[model samples]
Target: MIVSDPATPHRREGFESAPDPRLYNDDLAPTEPIRRTWTTYNYLALWFSMSMEVTTYMLASSLIAGGMNWKQAVLTILLGNVIVLIPMLLNAHAGAKYGIPFPVFVRASFGPMGANIPAILRAIVACGWFGIQSWIGGQAIAQMVAVLAPSTTGSPVVTWVCFLGFWALNMFVIWRGVESIRFLQSFSAPFMLIMSGLLLFFMLHKAGGFGPMLSAPSHFATHSAFWHFFFPSLTAMVGYWATLSLNIPDFTRYAKNQESQLVGQAFGLPVAMVLYSFIGIACTSASTIVFGRPIWSPVELLGEFHQPFLAFLGLVALLIATLNVNIGANVVGPSNDISNLAPSVISFRTGGLITGFLGLAMMPWKLMASFGSYVFGWLVGYSGLLGPVAGIMVADYFLVRGTQLDTYSLYRRGGMYEYSKGINPAAMISLVVGVAAALVGRVMPLVSFLYDYAWFVGFFLSGALYFVMMLGHRVRRSAVVS
Candidate 1:
């Protein structure tokens, strides 16, 4: 009803402009959204939050313990980071241009009828993470309480109650919607930085020197074994990192420009990432030196500190930082994704609430078993799905579609995206075929030999399938147009 003039100065243009007007559908875009104040520092802080969590700590320790020699692990980390950078930045470009969430962009490739496949898959994975991360945050509080209230028995009831309490708290924050999420990022990021600084200082003091510990491994493994372990974790990290690449447009759409997005990536990925890695390494290494054993949990590591005041400050900061990363990387992406499934019916906040409650009801504790870290492992499987989706989406956008998305059709059911009576079988078929191939390479017990390369396998499979499908479509279109 109220359409802003297309030529108005407030209208964004160029590569970053909304080329497809469908994105302006009422009740979709945020009102009074923040301009592109998200500079290199904000992106850096984002990646900082992402890479500095319990997962990062566990992965680093696993890399070293799995016999990757610290040097090999470091190489794997660097290489994996570089590999994810390309796709992440590409997706960010979409966000900057249109200011729409990632799932909305999916309609261009998957069609309005079938975009839900990837969107739902992404949302399911996100919900699991929501519960898991909330549980972890709750444990951080439990650890802090244990130190203060040493006599209180840490029973199952207390643990679950605290976990549920924290879970609800996050749900409330998310219910407040994107503005609340962004505000949380702004408020906590600086405090996390200060805490990280203090963490590094204390870790170095405990280590006696950074240099000695960097080279402190007492045992070494064969180069082949080192490669085996290093590559898996490295590949896993890349898969994990790229999980957000397809969805980052959710956040980057708020970014000011492609320049800002890249700046954010630069700070967000390599610089922010390596800083977090260094701190994680330092913290874990210091624990080894000081307590005579390595501790994977930052919460547990903080427990060993003597000063009560320092422990309190460190625990609170770590808790906030971990929660920030989970909410940003894990929650918001899926919120946008699930909402895109039925734009008329579900708003982003409603979708988040839906997924949040579903996550809690799934009994996430079942996913955690001694048989293996199944929950995290299942996440890796879900991440494998992301690679092909990215490859297909990227190929369709950049190669076949020429980076021009039909934004309007993304909202209307019988609009231009009705490629063939409500569904694009090619997209659906390619997704299944690609995911099947990836599952074989990653999780099919028989092909365990090639498991380390699942992401690469998935990427090529999806890209090739999508390309072939597009070729067929183009040829058919030419026949009709002539």
Candidate 2:
């Protein structure tokens, strides 16, 4: 029901033809309520599909390896997702009510052109993630090949070949576009659950029993030690899904109703995160009992499987799992960001190809180059950017505009969104303040502790600052509702 004033002309100065046909498509428009076809089940499948991936497994496994017992690891993962699902669901509101993608939704806050700044930051991270996922998928394939042909296991050439092959596979899926992705999720979702169940059984069998693994003694040794590790890991876990939080509108635009998106994500995200993180923790603990060390990477762990059949099957499961997540999380967001750069010139297909190329250029093997990069830099560092962006956006959409957007103005060259010549100084300034606070740890030795909770700090500070700045500019509602 929230929509733009239809009496207002859709055209604007400079760009006589706004949202040009060549560049514009229904995919990017503020979808009519009748056209919003996705149901709660679709949204559920979305989170269930995206969260059940190798990256998620690794997150849980890493926490376990970091000395948290299984209980603590599961608690952190559960609490983090429960916290993040708030913003994810809040942001989804505009998309469901108005049927606009994330870029256009934030355009109200950032500006017609300046929106690109935050969009690009999010896109770049997704691109890096695309490469990382492709590499993970490729590694899974290579591991399977090695089991079938042990001689080929360590060949760098083989790894690159498999990477390209998997990259091409992603490209093909993207070529077919979002509809294809939806189809993929529908089919892959059930399979993922079954495979995960099988993985759980395998772990239980390998470790001999669940009691020891579940009851594994905490490595933290003391409450203070546990808390120190808990906070950073918690932030990192939130950061894991922060990008998806910002861009969820990209998918929720198709939502049939708010109930569908909300209930679906509520059931799907937190539950899936807790379940997978539990598996990761349990499997890692079990590995210690069986293999003498806690192997965090599922790809490496599966590679160690003595039975070639199970190894190959596990690798296949990993590949399918990564594919389910990569296209949804990594490919779609960046592609939409790139397409936004020049809508008339770049379709979704073109943007996806660009994402694939950017993936190759980053050589994610290097980004995941070290455990430090994987754990702290890539996850926490990017959260500094995404968290502020999310904070400003949610504040603007919910507090400033009361979630009512002038949809037509979003595409026009000069309109309400052209605040301060296509840039909202209030939003930008708040973003800087938030990011600086989050990053102060880098320069100030005394404040280095803040670095561990960058996402939390950035989100809270940015949201508060933006709400205050916008309170002065926001058109107050007449006779506020109780």
Candidate 3:
């Protein structure tokens, strides 16, 4: 809208060639709302299941393991969800209103070519996440195998085979299509919940009672120590869902209405996180009592059970829970981003293959080596990259774009969005600075304290930088023309 070419403001469609239908068409347009079919109940179910998965469970325990009291960890997780919902809602509005996903929506501010900056960043993060989720599922299968053949359980060969097995299961379900996933999600949600309930029951039985078990102590001794851990843990908590905060449109686009997405996210995220986190914290604390040490990994905990029948059932539930989350969280966003990279050649299915292979190549095991690695390296690390992207998007959409985007121009290669030869330097440079700063904070001991607030620092700094530069870009262009 603020481009230099006078033709840009008024010229909506002067393309030398027609935009490829594969790139954009009815499927990617701001038409055909899913509003008719998606009731509030539908959204509630969607978000509920999305929240209660292996990732959330692992994250909750990681917080406690990292140093928080059980109560402190639950509160941190709850607060983080409530905070992230702000950006998630803002970003989802574009998708819900325009039916455009994240990559296209970013074209408004980043230019069509430059939009790839954030898209690729997000896809890469999702790829790493895909690996972690696959590892989780594979670990569950290994535990199950351990139940039957206790001798072979710890073999690296067995673990690698199980990992491939889990990966193939995801690929099969994906190739089978949305209807199959729907059934898997529905079936898995109930089984996952029941499994969690049973695990809680088991923990209670083993710990002697809730009163003694839930009294997990804060490893932080002093107020300074507690707050010191709190900030980073809070960042990790927010960073946990930072991916969904950006890519939520991939789901909310299917919402019946804005209200459905908003209300459902609000109602479901905090409550599910709080409740599920309680289960995690309680079970983890109970593990400390029963095992004489904390057992953060659920697979390892389940494997410790002597009864093969119960362990097998628990492993089955873990597989289903991790499987559903992997498909939804890992599969959808990266595939969409990948297809956007080369829409002509790559269909969503093809992109999914790319996502899977790249996920494996990322060697995400080192990132999840311990609860600490998972919290810091994977969760907080990716958040530092993703937070800036989310900030630019939300700021551009609401402040600069005025919540308006030309849907057609998004597909047109040389339309209004083709600022400065298909890239907005402001957006690109802002992204780099924010990401570089966050990375520096992560690795450099000098500014390492900033890593504790990495997401907040990156989000606010990038948003401010982009907004300011865009204003300056518009003002300078107007002056030169005058």
| Alpha carbon lDDT of each predicted model | 0.68, 0.83, 0.79
Off-target runs (Cα >4 Å) in candidate 1 are 1-37, 218-220, 362-376, 442-446, 474-482
Candidate whose lDDT is highest? 2
- Model 2 weakest lDDT span, ten residues long: 6-15
The deviation in Å at residue 159 for candidate 2 is 1.0
What tens-digit string does per-residue lDDT give for candidate 3 at 190-294?
667777989999999999999988776788779998888888888888888888888777776676678887887778778878888888889888998899888
Instruction: Summarize candidate 1's per-residue lDDT along 419-449 as a digit string, tens digits.
Output: 8865677788888877777777654667754
Give Cα distance to truth, residue 272, candidate 1, Å: 1.3
Task: Provide the lowest-lDDT 10-residue window in model 1.
Answer: 1-10
- In candidate 1, position 250 carries an lDDT of 78
Clashes of each: 2, 2, 1
For 199-226, candidate 2 gives per-residue lDDT tens digits of 8889898888899778777797789998
- Best candidate (score: TM-score): 2
